[model samples]
Target: MLRSSVHDHTVSTVPTREPRYEKKGLKAHRQLAEVQALQEAGQLDEALKKARSFVAKNKKEPAGWRNLGRVLIDTRQWAEAKRALDRANALAPDNPSTLINLSLASYHLDQFEAARSFGQQATAIEPENPLALNNLGMALIKLDDFDNAALVLRRALSVRPDLAPALSNYGAALNRLGQFSEALDVLMAALKLNKSDPYTFVNIGNSLRFLGRDSNAIDMYNQALALDPGMKEGSVNICNVYNKNNLFDASFTISSELIEREPKYVKAHSVMADSLIGLGRIDDAKAAAESVIAIEPASITAQALLVSLAARADDYDAADYLRAARRFSDLHDIYRPDVLANPADDAAKLRIGFIGGDFRRHPVGYFLKQLFTEYDRERFAFFIYHNAVEYDDLSDFFVENSAAFRNINNKLDRKVAQEIADDRLHILIDLAGYTKYTRLSALVHKPAPVQMTWLGYYASTGVSEVDYILADPYVVPDDCEAEFSEAVLRFPDSYLCFSEPDCDVPVRPAPVSENGMVTFGSFNNLNKVTDNVLALWARVLKATPGSRLMLKTMLLNRQDHRERITQRFAAEGIDLDRLILEGPSPREALLDAYNKVDIALDPFPYGGGTTSAEALWMGVPVLTKRGDRFLARMGGSIVSNVGLGDWVAEDDDDYVAKAAAFATDAAGLIDLKRGLRQRVLASPLFDGRNFARKFETLMTSAWDAYRARNDGEGR
Candidate 1:
């Protein structure tokens, strides 16, 4: 989810000065004073009239023009205020007060660069002006220069320690810098000075959300709404929190009302799309994303949603998915740094850097933990750039095992790329392609000589600067090379190396023997369970008499989500009595739940990665259909690598046949379950040491290729 910045159009106080023209400007100065009095008294219409009359009478007077600009700013007429402020600036070129007002006007008009320039000019004139520093800090936040904004806001507070606006903006900068706890302290201080400021409450909410205190964040947002009921930022923030927590029903309710109240609110549409996606309404989600694109053509959120939706659809098309990814890269192609020279010393340990946001207890973290522990430090030095807000014990493992670990969360893309380039890394690998909190834009800067994407994503990144994508023969075959923008670097065995689960849950016998009925289960994400997957499962259930299918995922915790799943199965002619729907559980419990299943069913087009590996570890044999693309073939790779090639089928009919054939032989199922774990442990899927050796060789070969190319170009 994207975070929002706070912007307020509170006009700065104009400085009092004597009239330049002793006799001719006396009337103009008196009229401007009366206008200021009316504005201070909240009679904006009368104040605007008096200010315009003053400016009309003494058009050449800078004080008259400045008074008119202040009145326009108070009335929230940003464009006219900018024009009046520009006139005042032309008359009195170095007036700090006029420049400050111009900065506020430009910020309100969405001219961030112009706002920054005006603020810079004001601060250049008066270095210790609190108002100038405050406005400049706000403009810097708008431009994603969080570090510099923090310094400027601190200087503002140093000049006037009790300045509420400066404190609020400083808290905002701290939140963007990933210092959430410090931001809370700064925001609370701002609240004590001015309890009625809605923007301060919103900033506090942002800090709470980033700190993983969702309920507290919601309460803060409610406080903001209570103070100003029509505040769009607070409402959108509440919707975002609900979506992140998988409370799609609540999110849908709020976002739908927001859209009705304001038709062209782009953030409302984006959150509405996320709600629809969580609710498993794919078509509605696509339409909502399209609505966002129509309203704001260059919205990166909308383009990324289209790409994810295409990859997860029932009728998955490789060409359409690639096009969507390409469109995202095109829109995100804002930074392109000059290529740096390759490393001069060939014998130095290759500096390999991995950049991603999933350094916590995520699938990417699990897979990477084993590789980090097994990497040969003699030939390589690992640098970790973590871009996530949350961290756990697994995150600590990454930091302890790496030579250098840098926390780059919430930093600007160009800044991150520059830091990576400064590290002098020989190779930089991206673990996140287009997922949330991705730094793919940083990769566009070509910070390293060899850049590759692996593991976290399942398809082409569509970034031309990315040199390659790590895959295996089963997932990305020879014929599908044209589908990717990068070269396909195929691994000899499996593309993924499974990290054994931390907990130990003893494998139990097949549930078929105890219940006298087979239970086929799938614990993949509900978003991957398209109508096609459901229909195929329905066919398998029909083929085997008295067989049941179990569906488990985090989304099933919601009553609406459970009902949606039940309704979809009923539409496929599957009875409710034969279905087992479950929600999330603890790690050990989740692993133990597989004890009740005889066969694990994998979803199509986007098959399971970590989920499939877990099912095998629990001794449940997975039956997956072979597919034509990388995402669709993940299950095939896992199943084939673990010496269970017979469990993989060629097509839908073959899949049903295999499921029926496997379930009909009760004794055979029992025998397979008893030895499945040991079988997987002995196969290449569980051979982490060998996998690391192959990985090292592959990376060294890629570096050699990069050096060859650079030598040919005489770089």
Candidate 2:
């Protein structure tokens, strides 16, 4: 087994040979011909030996240096090849052949810009040259300029229609640009010219994978590996397809093998991180993300992953993650403010925009119905910019409710930002704040006059372009504003406004009386049930005699999560029989599970938002231990808003006491359950009519504040 990597900084600074450039004599040319003959006979090492001897003997001939460079390239000695080519170019500075080989060596060395420069110089010297054009296009593709790469490669094919390399590279460029059908056509053309090209097969697999043809993509990747067993590109694509199919174990196997083969392979480490997360190994996922950051300091995605994992537990405060979020500010440090089309405009029409990833069957979508449907249509022209692929009935409702809807899933962040600016939105609201598949980078351009973040995240997003965070007095207090990057825009009662769930299930009487033993439960995400939260829940169960805890989550289906939960409880002296772990079920069945419990428990520091509301709506009162941060206090706000502030505990002792008291008072529990839904319906949490008015006022105020700031009339 071997683990190693090749990086751009590992190349030697000193030249491996003497620097000389001149076509010396006919003797040098004849020696070069002999070296070429050995290379053409499939003897790269022999050719390298002969070329080195020729260059050492004829030290002044540029032709000898060029021949040595060609042999070095064939031998896969990129650094030495670059040095030889550098010496050749120093002597014969105008030779297209020297420049072309220099570009090839640079490409192998991962010096993409240098390769493009050398290839461009060669093309300038010899117009309509297929070799130079194809090399330049491939270099641009490596640099992620896919649109121009496709154009350049197409021009190269026009000069030499049957050039297989150009066709293959063109297909890769189109595939990257999301033109999968066109890429397949170009790749098939390339395959007809060269049937054994492994990379062309990998590119075709990539196109198929992006087109959602996972089974076909896997077959193509296997074909690529069959042609070249050592091709990492094909293996990496296979791992990606496995992940797409939710086969995390298979993804882990292939990615781990790639990592063992090359420890510093960045893509392999990233894929491994995703696999780790899917398997519910938070600690391992964090470590994998850290490894990526150690390899490349500019990896914002890895940093985001680490922060999100830390936030799931009580490992750090909001201020800590808030500062970490500022790392993404460097992504567009050179961006200057563009003159707006509606600069210092009047308030005849206030256009508001909401951009998010989860406009589907998620908590954000559940809460967005009122805000989108109940807006004052004449006062505000609402727009939606969806950044995700998930679309369902609620998503269609959002589209129907809004004045305009645009799907920006395939657009680049900067391009989406520019389009938002073109739409002349007065206030752009971000519903996806660092959540999965969010386009947080788009807000860096500050497309609207005012930008606010809401719903998707619980704490400060730390993006400087976000002017405000829509919160409530209970969630974010006046003193906590210093910790946030954005201004804390407050609502009087609660920041949340949710509609009812789809279940017709009604609250039942206390289950404690029927079962003769209290059953406490938590329906929050398994990841939020951190070690600290689990330890606290153990104490609650211990305080209540004969009480059992019911934990249900999607991860409970995995044996690992179930085993881990059992081990944690064992440390607390709690029996495995007292714990009921259930996997995911249908929506109606999940809501019905609350009937089996007397009370629900909320995890600390990252408490439930929708889970708490749903539990209250289902006649199960949740006891949450309040903390200092917004995420920790979300349960408190919801309970306080629902007229049951006593259910939210002030500390750990209070939490355990509340759970015991609620479980023992069977009569009071029955009474609370019977009237729980009506209580919530009467509270501000589900009062969509009042929430809509307040939201409209908030947007109107934000617009006025923006106009005042721009007009030099400070608010």
Candidate 3:
């Protein structure tokens, strides 16, 4: 019912009361001690009554009100504590203890800036006050000033080494700075001081998660939950861990549990959407995200997920996706930093800023491996703005190779954008599109002279600030220009560039000759393999007698999903025996799946981009049909760029015919498979050097146009 721990002259608890003291000075002080003793004895109501009487009697002195404020703070009545503290401050203008109590009340009320200011005033009056110093450091950490927090916290620890709250706050600051190991060490020290602190365990879990120790992080989360079952942060964090582990069902279950308990927990709703997306339920994920937006219209988390769902839709509309995207972007306007120089600097050396979350081993990183490493150093100075949640070898490669790499991962989006603007980048490229954990909002500031979206997203970002979407002539044709917010900036050859993977596993020949049956496979995400795409694949299988269709994805592993997929195929007259379903595999094993597929089936309305590139590189010919928008036409662009025009079918009828024809002709399959990798290597699609040159030239052209448009405008 009450929380207080006595520690002699150290002033562990402050007891606030009214002016009812009959005696002055010494007797009034004795009355304050009596109130604190009553509180410590767990008689909070009796203590509060006595404090009120004392305050009512001794209205001339601030001590009665000070003691009352302290007792209110102990009861967690933050607003009431502030009222008492304000009275105490009015009576005793420079009392250090009253100032400290005022700061404590503000801290409990979540008024961090006010807390810091009061703590500063207290410290100035009594420079040796460890309590004030620790309070100020805690407020600094809350404000995300990790460096200043550490400094202030160190000063507090110097005065009182065993302060558990200071240690915990400092550790949290270290975790935010990405110093996980040191954070863990400091957190352990805090745990030693106060083993029952559930929040310390949550901070420990966060550090462990960031350090890639997922199992340990989960263990720490459990420890926190065991101590405090109602801890919202612990519940949400463990759910996030499950989502990251691809245990979507578990994540959804936990989030649902949280929702049932506290329906207004919008963060849980955002996590639920991520779980739905991972489960291959794009429509359900979209609904979940929309619900969060309904609750919190400006929620960036939900807005980004909504955009991701639109981008991943079976019937993706670039115009529709753009409109959805601007809803998120327009929520806050980012002012152009005053430091932005005149257009006179447009003629200066190229300074490029590439911002995104996937500067790690994700799809965006896999695609940019060649460019980040080989983009001509003398011509372009890179400022890689990495907003990463995790790290891998590719992350290091980009950071090490770039002229300057700033990890603005934990920084606010607008502030991070201003940092980019301060870099004076001539070309700012958003590699993350509308995907999760993106800086598309930052681009709204127009940080650089030339802003473009490329590689990461296939569709147009609705923001008018984005100048162009890098494309090949085949990808964004003249007819598709009106659907896009950005102008189509096409390359002479292809936009789908490739570099040799770190693993150059030898390519095997077509599976048709040995197996006696041509196998059609699509290793793309199951969400992309819509019902219509499945029906077409079924048609191809029925037309080509004795052929098998091998489908592999993370979803295929789930028994429920596997059965659903089987039933869906059976409804189309395709036997379960003819369908070979597979699930998640190791990287090398996934590449080996290409050896089993004679022809790769590119899923439509949302076809493959990286999957198609990988299929061709692994010596499997991908048959793709042209479609309306950028996402649908990725396969067409990839295949046509590698000089496989015959493989690009015109319609659904033509698609089935091509698959059947290609299956029957084993000789042609073998010939195409054998020569495919080399053809890709020689073509513009896989030419890294040529790709670098052309991309640089294109960037230069964009810069020149920016200069021409704003010749006199210094923006």
lDDT of 1 by residue, 1-715 (tens): 2222232222233333323423445666577778878988989999999888878877888877888888888888989999998999999887877899999899888798998999999999889998889898989888888999999999999999999889988999988888989989999999998998888888999889988898999999999889989887788889888888888889899989989998898888888888887777888989998998999898766776777677767777888889888888887565654565344255368788999889889989877877888989999889989887778999999989998989998687778888888888888899977666578878888888789999988789888889999999988888999989999998987999888898989999999989889999999889778788889999999999899999999899878788888998899888889999999999899999999899999998778888999999999999999987788889999999998889999999999999999999999999999999999877777778888888899898998887787674211
lDDT of 3 by residue, 133-213 (tens): 777776766665667777877887788788887777778777777788998998899889888877788888888888889
- Weakest ten-residue segment in model 3 by summed lDDT: 1-10
Which candidate leads in lDDT? 1
* Backbone clashes in model 2, listed as residue pairs: 21-91
User: Which candidate has the highest TM-score of all?
Assistant: 1
Candidate lDDT values, in order: 0.85, 0.78, 0.78
**What TM-score would candidate 2 get against the native?**
0.84
Stretches off by above 4 angstroms in model 2 are 1-27, 33-41, 57-71, 88-104, 116-137, 153-175, 178-195, 204-257, 276-284, 309-313, 330-332, 336-348, 388-413, 502-514, 712-715
lDDT at residue 648 of model 1 (Cα atoms)? 92
C-alpha TM-scores of all predictions: 0.95, 0.84, 0.87
Local distance difference test, candidate 3? 0.78
